[model samples]
Target: MARSDIRRSAPSPRGGKSSKEQPRGWRLFFRRLFVWGFSLALIGVLSLAVAVGLAAQSLPSYASLKASQNEQMIVVRARDGTQIVSLGPSYGKWLPTAQIPQVMKDAILSTEDRRYYSHIGIDPVGVARSFYVRYQQGKFRQGGSTITQQLARTVFLNNSRTFGRKVREAVLALALEWKFSKDQILELYLNKVYFGGGAYGIDSASRKFFGHPGSSLSLPEAAIIAGLVKAPSHYAPTADADAAVGRAQVVLGLMVENGKVSADQARGVDLKGIKFAQEGGQNSVRYFTDWALPQLDLLLGENTKPIEVWTTLDLKLQNSAASAIKNNVPAGTQGALVSMDRDGAVLAMIGGTDYVTSNYNRAVNAVRQPGSAWKLFVYLAALEAGYTPATEVVDEPVTIQGWSPHNSGGGFAGKIDVRTAFAYSKNTVAAQLGNEVGFSSVASMARRFGITTPISTVPSMVLGSNEVRVIDMTRAFAAVSARGKSIEPYGISKVTTTDGEVLYTHEARSSVQLVPENVANGITDLLQSAVSIGTGQAAQIGRPVAGKTGTTTSNKDGWFLGFSSGITTGVWMGRDDSRPVAGLQGGHAPARAFAAYMKVAVSGRPVERFQTDMVAPAFQISPDDEASFSGSPDEYYYVDENGNLVEPPADKTAARRPSDAPEDPAPGPDDANRGGLEAVDPPPAASEDFLNKATGKEKSDGTPPN
Candidate 1:
């Protein structure tokens, strides 16, 4: 049984050859196998040929990937369409061979490619020498990449540290040599290489680090630039001056030893006082640019391809603003200034004290309590609610819905005219007005004026408990200064391509009417008083000006927002962590900065006054009063000379206060210094109709009013 099973499993054959002895079938099978093998090999070869052809066709674009590279950068212009800064695409600017100094050429040749003219892309001798040196060091140390190989790495090859990437770089370099002449390759290489300090290419580096173009580079500067090829950031003149100079000397010596430069030339070069542009006055503006760039992108779209944007930045104004902030603000304090034209174009913006240390724009990014600066919106709401600029408001402490707001001082002023309250920044008057005009309606009015911050109907909101950004606040108030027209603030004006083709244009959009002309005029008048005699007195600019001053709790934030006939500016000073700044107030730093900036921003420009009708707003008054309820002292009519309530023919003879209510006390002092008087909750006053109906009706006991 075992033998039969073994025989059955051992072997099987179709023909009588025991499966291994069929010579003719085996021969035919071998022939067919040979033909199939030949066909498969041929197909593989053809497929490889097609792939190579396709790669060759695409190789021209990346051929000189290592030769030279240049990146195009867009630039931005200040107001008047003057360039303020440039944005780099690849940190490169193309320069011809003739435009580069011989010293620079010799220095680079000695350091990078000694036999570049003779090599066929790969320098085998150099590679072998580098390999030998590396082997001796027992580690991967030296790189033997030719200038073309560098170009390939910088342009076509990824920066992965792998043998595959090196092989690909070599292949790309060979293709580059096949497609371009040596001089063209050199030209491109010089134009594309990075030399550090935000500079790309020899032309930009030559100017940035050496303060000269490539053609004007001295021997020392040329050597320094050539040496930077090893480590651009480390050897950058701006970063490590001593190290860079030492490295530059090494490059000079190498050039001499390589016969690229004479020893005399090396000895004659001096690198002393070789300062970088970033180490000089140009650094002053970097902070401002860093903060402004992202904002431009956000407003103009991410693909603002042109590196240059035409902004309304006035350098003189910016300088003045910065100087004023530095001088007036505390040592650790941060500040921002935003100035706009009447059309709402942001003429200048200074976002922080140091852009390099911080890109956070305290002006546009930080939202803090607006404090008394918010009274402008409050007054606007009152005016829209039929209260005149001259309306009478009791400046005494009064509580509503369990909230009590005090003026700056703890004492309460009794009665005051609206204009005087606003001019003096009396908190009680504004809070009372907020109560009189429904809080929700006032909030709606603020929203219409473009106050983007979410506002709650709490009583404290009348005092700017809501947080607001300087830019948004300025824009909102600028609408008031612009005669009731609300418009968005923008920095960029237009963007264009290098060929002068306009890629985008930012037109000032249509403005919304936030308040009526008369209401705006009244508020503008109050703001003028603020600059003339109120907390914003420091902002007076020797011309008719209008402005408001704001100081938040604990002096944590201070602001002075103002406008002239032509330009409006908002200044803010505070700490980043929302801590208190000692003795800081709107009248101190922010006002001073605003004034300083305006002096320069409006220099040589006409001095214009804000336009107003000079007419007082009409106010709603008691029916028994012959005089209107204007806040003027003469207009208040409690004792109408006859010991009777002034009225528009009301039946007041028989009327009396409820027996349970407390007596209405006479108004007291109007000075802002006496602000807090322990605000007491009072019963809701009757509506005008309800009061008219109850007037002259005595209680059943016929007692005098409580």
Candidate 2:
């Protein structure tokens, strides 16, 4: 009975075999099938191992991978060690794994690799899921890479979504897992991932997005940063904060699902408090940084290591300058301001009101007509030609080589002293002075005073017809405040490596003397009068100041170049397209900006007077005589070195007098106080004859007559 039951329960094998034997044969067939399948699976595994090894042979060596870790950032800092900007491929501070906030670590793991701790460099389940997703989508839509794999790819591989790269990435990821801990791999990933806005690594991304450090990141902020690893440009908080926060919400949900945070905690995250980085003040200093960056390359050639640049910029002053320009200047109009010490150490500079909108540095790159400000060199030339502040020159309209220059304010004062002409910015007098001194002499004088712009020998050059940069004009005026010393303006004070090795140091050097002390003093006295009582009155800052105001003919450019005993600053207001700024004049916006900036710039400094003593004329005039001569008739009056009226030598021809001829109609307000006239016909020979007759000798034009 037991044998029959066994035979009934047993399976059949072959045609001639019993039921029991058939069950044995069926078992044998199943076993053979299992062995063949197992053998094929083993061969496939061996083949995959061979393929991985072959891919690994073509990959970069471990030494190169280690060497790639040496990439550093360039940090531009102000004099006070405050960071201004960071520049380089890896533009961020390297943070250690311990320094990274735990929330940030969790956020990264949750979003990038949920099984990061449990997996050995790769996750089979994630790869299979990703493959299914890609197959359904008909494209490679997801990267099934672990954190270790990402670190390997970022350190030694390009970001190409290809099968070969994936193989190499997997091989290298295994190598990284063998060599480093999970924390080590995570730290490398955090320090090397790109977070958009040109930032690389967690520290830079933290500072860029939140204006803080990685160690201080909140959960939401960490989630936001972790979200950026998926697509940096698309999730950049600065460009699209909503997109960034939305992605961060996804990360937060993942974090909660992974048991890293509670659902209540995830819901409690507030993105409102996260202040996205702005391109305003953080980038306002970029104007100065841009100017100073090239100089660093010049100072330290071909340097690959990270360098710290210590600039002369006072961030406070820089901020003030930018604010003043933004608040004071008209919207469509652009402005530039540069401030420097008497020794040419640039203290503050703003190339444009908004650096992000336009990076063109007007202070250092723009070359526009300075108008009456160019008269400084003209007057300087006259002083060098033995003309003192008390010397008299006719202010009537004058023409040279077809360039007829008219005085600002239209009507002439009949005749005036050189000091009065300069103070009032009388264009005719400046042109006549240019003629008397010869245009070449004025051009040479400008070159000597640190104007690097090309100057033409045209007579209108005396009225600032020649274009110039604000920095050049500021440097020129600095020489005046420095008592005629030549100045070379510079921004960077020192440069050093992050490791504290000195790369470059700008030595504080004495300036070269360009103008005679007496001549400089005389010029300073004239310009000081301009600020105190003339067109530059708007630039007055309660304390003594010396500067000039200039407006181009069509109001295309306006300028205020002034200086105290300690600092010299120049301001320019104009349009980028060279179009006229409506109602813009040097005495208006430019002067106002200059005054506002100087008031803040000199707040803490003691009020110091200019060197008036050095400006004492070679000859002195009696107080009573100077007073009595103020209301004298409109006749040509000759003065000697002592500023006393003197008769011409009897042996020379008698001085000619201006006839009672009717004067030309007065100029309109638009014509008066403008930059000046353009090229016109040469003045009548009779005018020179009159001068020759008055001096009782041939006219001295500062050149040998042909």
Quote the positional error of residue 115 for candidate 1 in Å.
1.6
Q: Per-residue lDDT for 1-706 in model 1, tens only?
A: 9999999887556554453544578788998899999999999778755654554467745334433234546676777765556667434345687887888888888999998999978899989988898889976666888998887787767679899888777776776777678887787778777778777778878777766666677787888899998998899887888878989988988898888878887788778766665534433355456655666555556563435667767777767777877777777889888888888777777778766677677777788898999888788877755566566565666577898888887876655667778888898778777776656545555655555556666778888888887887888778888887765666667767654777667876655445556678888889998889888999987887899999999999999998985788888999989999898899888898888878777777787766656444333234234234223212211212111122212433223335554533322333111211111211233234322222323322454445
Writing each residue's lDDT as its tens digit, candidate 2 over 215-326 gives 7888989999999999998999877899999999999999999999999998888976788766445556887888778876678888777678899888898888887787
Model 1 off-target regions past 4 Å? 1-56, 60-74, 80-92, 273-291, 295-306, 498-500, 614-706
Candidate 2 stretches with Cα past 4 Å from truth are 1-72, 88-93, 118-120, 216-218, 262-280, 613-706
Give each model a TM-score: 0.77, 0.77
